[model samples]
Target chain A: MTSSSVPKRSRSAMDASAAATQALYGASDPGLRIRSIVFRSALLLSMTVALIAIIGIISWAVVEGGQRLSLGLLTNNPSSFRPETAGYRPAILGSFQIIAGVIALIIPLGVGAALYLEQFANKQRWYNRAIELNIQNLAGVPSIVFGILGLAFIVRGPLDMGFIAAAGSATIALLVLPTVILASREAIKAVPPSLLEGAMALGVTRWQAVWKMVLPAAAPGMLTGIILAVARAIGEAAPLLLVGAATFVTFDPNFWEGGYSALPVMIYQYAGRPQDEFHVLAAAGVLVMLGLVVVVNSVAVWLRAKYERTW
Target chain B: MKELGKEKLMAESASTKEEVFSLDGVNVYYGDSLAVKDVSFPIYKNEITSLIGPSGCGKSTILRSLNRMNDLIPGARVEGDLQYHGADIYGSDIDPVQVRKIIGMVFQKPNPFPKSIYENVAFGPQTLGMKGNLDDIVEEALVGAALWDEVKDRLKDNAFGMSGGQQQRLCIARTIAVKPDVILMDEPCSALDPVSTYKIEDLMMKLKEDYTIVIVTHNMQQAARVADKTAFFTVSSNDEEGSRTGVLVEFDETGKIFSNPADQRTQDYVTGRFG
Candidate 1:
């Protein structure tokens, strides 16, 4: 309606209408504000709790073992009677050797399994579904159960490789294989289906498309997964203990047929002893293990940042 | 509607042009349900044939089936005669890979590999073992797509760094690097802006000199601008069975399909009366 054709209201009525409109678009109720604040605080509190636990553990290790952190910790060999001069030379070498083996075993096996499942397997088949279900379940199985299997299969029965660094590597690799496969599958799945179709439309066979385009696109993520899985394998002590990461070894580990000691197994042995000095040595071992894991995880983060694709 | 389309096709068959693809009573199915029913048409050599329709009318399905891209989806099946150069593409002995090598596709979205622009173009020729200087092939394909000048200095850069239109053109470059006879594009310009769309339409016009193109598009004006022939599809739903099937209402020269359509549905669609 035109302005001149409309009736004009009194000043009091106009004032009342203006006030109603103002109130209609005014600030939200106090209940909503309080609820929003509570939700945000809860989220912050959850993050704080996780951060505190990690920081607390790192600080505790530093306080308990800072005095023992020296060049001697890396150079000298372990001594049972003399904890003062003892170091993690053999244990450090042993951890590296087993990890190398684990990398060799897991890269081909884990990536191969993930590729088979993600790219080739028909989801309509019952067995492929069963295999996927089993791999997921395997990731959740206790690490000690893997130790038992390793003892029965690799160390003593069937393959009979004996208690050496190779056996320890095989056991830890088996324990982390499920994690690697799951992560690799996620990375492969993250590559767009359109990319595959684009490649196929160009006349490449399925394998060539996967090997050339799909794998390179998925490499950074797969590498990140491998590094994370290796980190988890590094800190595992229970399975290695059963697979024979010995309590004490003076010399460097032989990959094939000699005694070896991983950092975590040595730490566990030291913590079980009666001396306070040995407990400090155990804490020092924890520091070394934590450093290795942090370095590996940093590599993963850098690779992801460098190569992740937006489209 | 079906009879009118057939009559038009019969009249067009009097021409001496070679047919690259000939479909008769083609029916596409996903599982037991028919998705597109009785699609009959001829795609001639070096011609741009556009499929135009509203949503859920199986336009993309028909385009994808031309290159056997629908085989990638589980339970998707095609029936009736679909011949590529007088041979049944679906014959038991014909390898789908071989069929795809002859018929390449461009998708609705630009899906370049997460690699350098040079690598993206080089991948197809390298995989197919095409004998040539690799650099020259990539440069030629980029030139053919009208992208070489903008990207030649930055061939080593990642394909993802380009603009949307540039990336789509790079996808076109990658497809043509394989040297396929037919290129099937599924709504290639729907994801682009107006300028990019027209650029692609212009590219399509130039490309028709070398390649037989069958494009599915929601833009009717695009068909009018670049297409030599047009096929109009509409959805026919059965309320009792709760099913919708795509039916070809008309097929003719691009001029007649847009200006003087035979079927009422085609007339209404071209005039924007209703989808």
Candidate 2:
């Protein structure tokens, strides 16, 4: 009978242990229900902490940033060391110009490379496998290394185009291209095989099916990936620093000319000056850049939500 | 419409039942594995030929072999003569894409593209570049599939919104819209309800007036019910790494095949003796 009651006995034994432990600390004697509430409360507390950290950071930035945000802040170039004396206009313009250049560079190269890897190239061949391996490795390689490569190749060594905006754009674009290609490949591959077969069975040619049907269906997710890649490019500081983003240029620089500064580099320069005014100016610049990235990423997220396929 | 009427009138002559295609000593290989061995069969104009067999018996293989749908499978190689109206279909220069344009197919599951209902029927005709009256052609195809009355009000609605039977019929409409000479079906009714199956069965009888259809089914009664002719396929294996090689065990008029079969295997299968 005792052996048959093993499950009940063990359960009671656990309750006895609880009671014994309760006797050792008299005030801690709560029911299972109360203990469960405490356990869940701990989990909820951790979640609240996470929420607080995120909201607190955003709130702090937004509050500190409110005073400096104006048309002058958005549209005028920087003077020096003073919050009233400085604006992110040049940096904002430079960021826009850099983003446009990177987009132009990425679309054709990234999508074409992805298409070649997925559709045209035979994955079974060793050379193709080597090429695939190289791309994956390139995706993981640090952005600073890409900057070094860009400086040696594009800025001075072979091409020697000087410290131009085009050079900075190209360097950042190259840094993010592998990410675009990798993401686009995943989006393209995620299209159902049944969909491909359906198209093929309809007498549409393979190229027609891929272009007209498959590409359109997969485009939204791929665009989302492109947006994230562009976001990463804008936030990147190491590569742009080496590629020559100027610290305090008053006028808009051409793609061919000297010293172009972007948002991050401008913020870095102000933050390093060690004056209270410069620190406030740096925070304002940080807010502006964060806002721009949020707007851009919001657009991408909107597009993804609008066109996302259930299948 | 007039041309279709004339074609129908001409086909009324039984002597006009010319051979649409012929396969001579045909062998199908998927990579190194042989799927069909030394198979030969003739397809007649405007006939419903049902291929029946057990699972993995290559009934679908024989159906796909007719239009080279098997070419979609990488490393699939077909040897020996497969002829379409006395032309060498497997010749190096002959494009399988072109062969496919002339022969459409409906799959087991009713696979409609995730598009509007009107777009689904229009897809094939658009690809084939049919000239003049796109709206008319779409309507005719839908009506021919016996789906126009049900779907006429909501041509702009999504294809997936329709019932399973409607989707299958839409697939049929898509196939006929291309004006292909033949249509191959692979277990099309397997995913259908009994009522939908009957409707499609009736649709098949009407479609045979214009298109040559070759179907594969596991249901013996379906073969007995709708087919004008029947082909029985079977597979055999030995001890040493034996591959599945489908053989045409019997072929005859549908009524004859069901009522009085010449092959022992055919009788066993039809009478539900064993797979």
> Best TM-score goes to which candidate?
1
Residue-by-residue lDDT tens digits, candidate 2, B1-275: 22223254234445656777788988888889888888788878889989998887778887887777887776788898888776777877667776776778898999888899999989777866879789999999999999999999999999999989999999999888877788899999999999999999999999999888888998888898889889888886655886667788888899988889999988998888979
Model 2, TM vs. native: 0.86
- Tens digit of lDDT per residue, candidate 2, span A1-311? 55566698797898899899888887554597798999999999999999999788677767776677777887777877456767887777788888889999998899888878876787768898898889999999999998898899989898897778888989999999999999999988988766766777777887877777778778887898899899988888788888889557888867678788889988888888867777777778878878878988998999988988876
**Cα RMSD (angstroms) for every candidate in the order listed:** 8.0, 7.6
The residue pairs in collision within model 1 are: none
Give the TM-score of chain B in candidate 2: 0.93
Residue A14 displacement in candidate 1 (angstroms): 29
Record all residue pairs in model 2 with backbone atoms less than 3 Å apart, i.e. clashing: none
Docking class of 2: acceptable
What is the per-residue lDDT of model 1 for residues B1-275, given as tens digits with 9 covering 90 to 100? 22213233224345557798899999999988999999999988889999999999998998988878888898899999998777777877667776787788998999888889999999999989999999999999999999999999999998989988999999999999988788999999988999999889999999988889999999888999999999999999999999999999889999999999989999999999988
Distance from true location, Cα of A50 in model 2, Å: 6.5
